[model samples]
Target chain A: MIDAIVLRDAREHWRMLLSWAITAAALISLQLSVYPTVRESSAGLQQFIEQYPEVFKKVFRIEDYTSAPGYLGTELFSLMLPLVFIAVGAAWGSGFTAEEEEQGTADLLFALPVSRVRVMLAKGAAAFLSLTAVGIVCLGTLAVGTGWVDMSIGWRRLAAGTAVCVALGALFCALGALLGAATGRKGAALGISVGLALALFVLYSLAPLVNTFDAALPYNPFQWTLGSDPLTTAFTPGSVLKPVGVAILALAGAIAVFQRRDLRQL
Target chain B: MTTAPKVTPLRALPPAEPVLEVRGLSKWYGRTHALDALSLTVQPGEVVGFVGPNGAGKSTTLRILMGLVSPSGGTADILGQSALNGSPNVRSAVGYLPGSPALYPRPTSRECLRFLQRVRGIDCRARVAELSARLEVDLEKHIHDLSRGNKQKIALIAALMHSPRLLLLDEPTSGLDPLVQREVERVLREAAADGVGILLSSHVLSEVEALADRVVMLHQGRTVLSAAMADITGRLVQRLTFEFADTAAESWFEGVRGVAAVEAHARHVEVTVNGSQAAALDAAAKHGVIAVHSHEQRLEDVFTELIPERAA
Candidate 1:
């Protein structure tokens, strides 16, 4: 049985976790329901899409509006799903440390006999578990929506895409955790996590338009998550491995920083 | 000097191994000194009162002992284990109540206690129930809805539930009502009787005087006084007020060997005596003293006398 901080964190966040999972499910279902209509209007939609600037279409991952995966990728995975996960991840990560310190609860927490590393690891595990739950919910909802829409999307592809989403979410969650550990301030953690995610998104989007940025695409976190188009491509180990590796590194960094720094109560 | 009150432990016990020890413990935040080369020890079953004004490193020392903050130099030990690198076994034997405890808002007091019980890996339900009843805390009430005193009671219950060997309490009676304060004091006494070592920090001098076997007074991040309760009491100055037939000059009492301070009004004078009062009384009697009233020195007065700059 998980003890102490992990169990306490999970209990505290039960409602927020449920809400995030439900929101993910709702957003995925709502977008997938519109897929058939988008396919029906593809000819008209393609003409409208052509009028969109090349950079905008590329930024939004607008390609083959008739295909199930392509349409879902553009409408749901490209922005909406990532945004939801980022928000959830950032909120959980920041709350794990920074918010506790801000509210003066860290004093009570650190007073326990457990080591700081153990506490940090427990909180990290809780955040990862929450993001994983949201990802699983999203995959289940996506499968249900596909069945309802009479779409022939493979379960394997959806699983692969969801895996990519989880990895991406974990990456940003780790970013938030790192900032939370470093700053011991919730506002700074949230701001830096969201700001970094947005900056990476913008950088990845502009890579094709600008040669200078295109050269940096391989190293970009946004590219690692969606650049391979997980819905269409076969599962490539590197695609998932890179983000997972980085997420692990970030979490490790968070643990190290938290262990060394004083547990400040705001 | 007028005789200071003879202070003694409310309950006497044989000396035992130190349950809490700090040797040359120092902490610095950049250029500001939080704790200087401070050292102290708490023996088993002893209550050591940690006294200091605001920003006087009392909290810093407690934080260091709890392993919530790293020290710049020196070592702190609890039960012979390094406190700076605390372990579950070590922490499980220790109970701490922060100066300003903030429990999770979402949980009811019952739920919060349950969580702490699980975290501490102790079956403390009976103890929790007993403590909650004693402290008059409503366990069913959500912590967010409770008043500060009620919340403090919940924290006190949590800290005491496990019956740990050592209790590091920071302002334990703060924000509590007099009734609750008395209850807490009783609990501390009971815990000490159980051979639990306690290091308590508070702004309340009377609380310290009542409970501490030894009083360690800190000023500006350093220990100014560390003595047995009796010694601290013996150092306290007596305050004497005299109403004289004729107005007396302040210098008359000042000339007395034991008089520490003298204030003269129109027909009345107040004298603070450090040792024997005979010389001061004789001086007042020579001025046609009509009536003389003497007051035992309070702990607060002693604290101010020790830390004069703070008084100023």
Candidate 2:
């Protein structure tokens, strides 16, 4: 039953999938066209990397930037993935309950034969499917883009990074669902989702500068996207645990809130 | 010849133990009491009309029953289940159509209905088709593209498709066109006749008069009056206008037992009185009721009187 609801939601929100595909295609095409020239100027690139290590590190992890798979994995999966997930989460959060109320569908939805928890669960499942699909497209696009650069890809590292990206996306998805269940207003839910993600991003970027927060790196899902090693090594359970745990907890909280909330509006 | 399978009589069918029993239900939003000790019982196959004005607590009561909103002070059982007991089973057996109908516009009508049906564990294509045809809903249209009335029709189909034992409909006809409205009314009546317990809320007096056997009037969230339509109407005073035997004859009815008021003119006397025409006839006979004409108070008049003008 949960799967059915999720699948139905995906089919209903297929427009999101189409939009994600278009963006991913454009990004992959741009990378394939530009990265070859950058890689050929190894000495210049090395000098540039040395000249502004912080900027290089900020954009792409310099240690793994030599291999096209490594560079794209960090730059695309790490930085770009979060942005995509945040956009998706924002859309899901605002559209979930608020749209129903705004359109007057919430009233009819709550009146149905299914429980509110089940409805939220279905919505979460659909969002998860969408976010996962986005991650897959990201991974696939990068893999094809790697071929264009004549770079041999390390499958293990890409998979680990993609998994973490998907997990963090799921976290946002769950939060978005919770925000949706909390209120019937679209702008409010959207603000909460976007605001929370932006704050987290700021905290993450400034973490190295904050002396007190330096010790909390392991707990952050953002660190998981900064790929360490691939092909030769599998992902560490330690790095994956936090995102998986947070996603699970967020989903549970969403269900809890949904069960008791009036949802009388839609 | 072999006996055909016999269907049980509607009345003989046992009441599905009051899925929702509203008792002394009262709700107050801040200083205003939206529902004032309103109570009603919904038995299987009984379609009860909850009629009241805009501010009446019809929506509040339904919201409480669905566990969407908590009542300030009241108890209700949904399919013999209570929210306190942690039972979601009531939802499984219930189908509701709120005063306002809304759905996820991203899906086509078919997708929305199919999702609802799957969750309810009912293969309801036939049921959906039945209601769709009756409501004249275009299932192929994307919900976003559909008009308000069409959206309501979709909601009605969704609610009825599952064939729930208890249905709570609030202003189900508000957005529907007259033809579609009649179709919805017919469907509701048929559902009741088929033994589905229904509680319908509407301020459209004529619709209520057509669809409900009993009317429960809510005033300030409290049930001001609830009775079989005939009984309430029977008890209310009717207006009696007669060409008085003489203009002076109106004064003679001032002290009559059943006559509450009399307005006399040169050619006619209009007397408002309680009870049957026999009482008025008997009283007027004494004064030579030469051309007595009577108009019984309708359900609308009784409804108006029961709920104070300001409260309504």
lDDT leader = 1
What is candidate 1's local distance difference test score? Answer: 0.84
Q: Each model's TM-score, in the order given?
A: 0.90, 0.88
* RMSD of every prediction: 6.9, 5.0
DockQ of each: 0.41, 0.46
lDDT of 2 by residue, B37-100 (tens): 8778877777788988787888878877877777778688766666333335556667788777
DockQ result, candidate 2: 0.46
Worst 10 residues of 1 chain A by lDDT: A1-10
Q: Summing lDDT over every window of 10 consecutive residues in candidate 2 chain A, give the lowest-scoring window.
A: A224-233
TM-score of model 1's chain A:
0.94
Q: Model 2, residue A248: what's the lDDT?
A: 71
**Candidate 2: which docking quality band?**
acceptable
Proportion of native contacts kept per candidate: 0.71, 0.53
